[model samples]
Target: MSKAFTKEEDGTEKIRLDDLPQSTHPNLVTPSGLADLKARLAAARLELENLRARPEEIDSTMAIAVAERDIRFLESRISKAILIDPKDHSSGVVEFGATIDVVNEEDEQLTFRIVGEDEANPAQGLIAPYSPLGVALLGGETGGTVEWQKPSGVVELEIIAIRFE
Candidate 1:
């Protein structure tokens, strides 16, 4: 219902880059990102195992291509994965991968995880920082509240917690 506004000594309102942390945690693996790579590896391994089980299929070029493609993708991803230092370490501010909990006036507690654009899945409560709600909640403090516009109307949220390490 409210927002964390800062005022200068001159009584002028101050703008913020974000309310949450922007730094990547020590572990930058988005669940989806990690899962995608893992699934590919597993699929490729399974295909290799299958080839051993069914010797007749071992010589099938098409079958080999199916498994090889998965392996290639995994190799490409893990090789280029950039593990960056956590962007915002201030415990006072929210950042990426922070599991924020907010209580609406209705007393319903909502949970969200700020993630990368490619990793966002609202159905799973993972939000991309570029999203309106995510942008509003970035660099926020645990006890701070925020407001942002939604398709329906103005929506409010409280920052219950944030994690950076």
Candidate 2:
């Protein structure tokens, strides 16, 4: 019989999965952000252990690949986290971990909390410190005006208040 007709051994082929890329920017994180990263890393490690212990319960190769990738990514992120306590920063200036209240030219009030990239959720008002609005707001004091260059156009935001958590 031709070799093609024979059953191949289980370990005959190997599958390689590439690691997730790490961000080039500094891993600036709030105290909560660092805690969240650590928690996620712990969860990933638990999941990896579970996957390895029960390889016979599922598609072991693909499942193991995903779990391992998550572990590596979370571990790297946790390792790179630089925790910055909001209370330790300047009280009056808009800096990282500062909660800011601003008003646009249209008189619409908005609030944003500057946080780490990993903890940024724009819809919920959490913004990355390097984001356009965050950059414009940083270093600003109460009653200051900043022009944010958005893709639509430049929008001016007036600083109403700034507080640290």
Candidate 3:
């Protein structure tokens, strides 16, 4: 067996960490999103250091491997990030970092912030720029209707407002 796979004196096998898959879409990030990524990277590094300092603890090896994997992923994201401030973008356009309010065909109103893929949280009303709805909303003027194909069928949304903050 290779030394890498060998068991340690405490009978814990050396864990191998795998790199996370990178997103193919462009890495556009808001200023706050970039800050979040940097903070996560710092926390991951600190966790990894703590895990390594207690190598003989048996469970620490797996924890260390996980932390290392997170660090690698965060580092990649930070390096590839392209910061874009919503305040700097032109008003009334659905560019990245724009918060938009829309009304659906059913007269239900919804709000979403167009953000980078990494920062997207659908439940939080944050949508990725490459999403079907996001793409349709881009360049759409207020009071204009945009249609997108959804799993249920085609859905239409009328842009009620656009704001960059």
Candidate 4:
């Protein structure tokens, strides 16, 4: 192959990574979720700066690209965030940011907090509003039963308590 037809001789060409895709859902966020997004953006900015400052130390092209991409994603998410304080919400029914205690048909007690997509950590009992359980629990009053459509099957859960912080 001729060197004239090649574009990777000295590896001087700047690699432009593709932008991260944005979500189509509404950007609903609790107070804590918004704070987390801001913190992530700050960290990404710091990482990018550090990588640029010490570029000669290693091949940081990929690191810098990743950091820049994360910064873009976090900034976009923060910009579109609709902060909702749970304290301002009514306590009569389940809603976003509501912490609920439920008893399943198997008599197992479980707790979950309805949160935004960015703040969802199901393993930690935090669920997104669009999740099957969250969808079923939302608007449910305490002592009411809701059916959760899990991938395995439908499970009935009785809401024992509802609280907001």
Q: How do all models score by TM-score?
A: 0.54, 0.88, 0.89, 0.90
Model 4 stretches with alpha carbons more than 4 Å out = 1-11
Off by over 4 Å in 1: 1-43, 48-64, 84-90, 116-121, 130-132, 147-154
lDDT of each: 0.65, 0.84, 0.87, 0.87
How much RMSD separates candidate 2 from the native structure? Answer: 5.6
Order of the predicted models by TM-score, top scorer first: 4, 3, 2, 1
Alpha carbon lDDT at 86, candidate 4: 91
Looking at model 3, residue 139 earns an lDDT score of 88
True lDDT of residue 145, candidate 3: 86
Relative to the true structure, candidate 2 reaches a TM of 0.88
Q: Global CA lDDT of candidate 2, please?
A: 0.84
- Candidate 2 stretches greater than 4 Å from native: 1-14
Give me the displacement of residue 136 in model 2, in angstroms: 1.1
lDDT of 2 by residue, 1-165 (tens): 111222237543323467777888888999999888888888888887887788576476566667777788878888888888999876678999999999999999999999999999999999998899889999999999999989999999999999887
Top candidate on TM-score is 4
**Residue lDDT tens for model 4, 1-165:** 111122346664445567788888888899999999999998899999999898675668667767877898999999999898999887769999999999999899999999999999999999999888889999999989999999999999999999998
RMSD of 3: 3.2
lDDT for 28 in candidate 4 is 88
Clashing pairs in 4: none
Q: What are the per-residue Cα lDDT tens digits for candidate 1 across 1-165?
A: 223347769774433222222334233445555666667678788886775466455354345444555566566565555443344455667776677888776778988877765457899888877788888898778888998678998878877767654
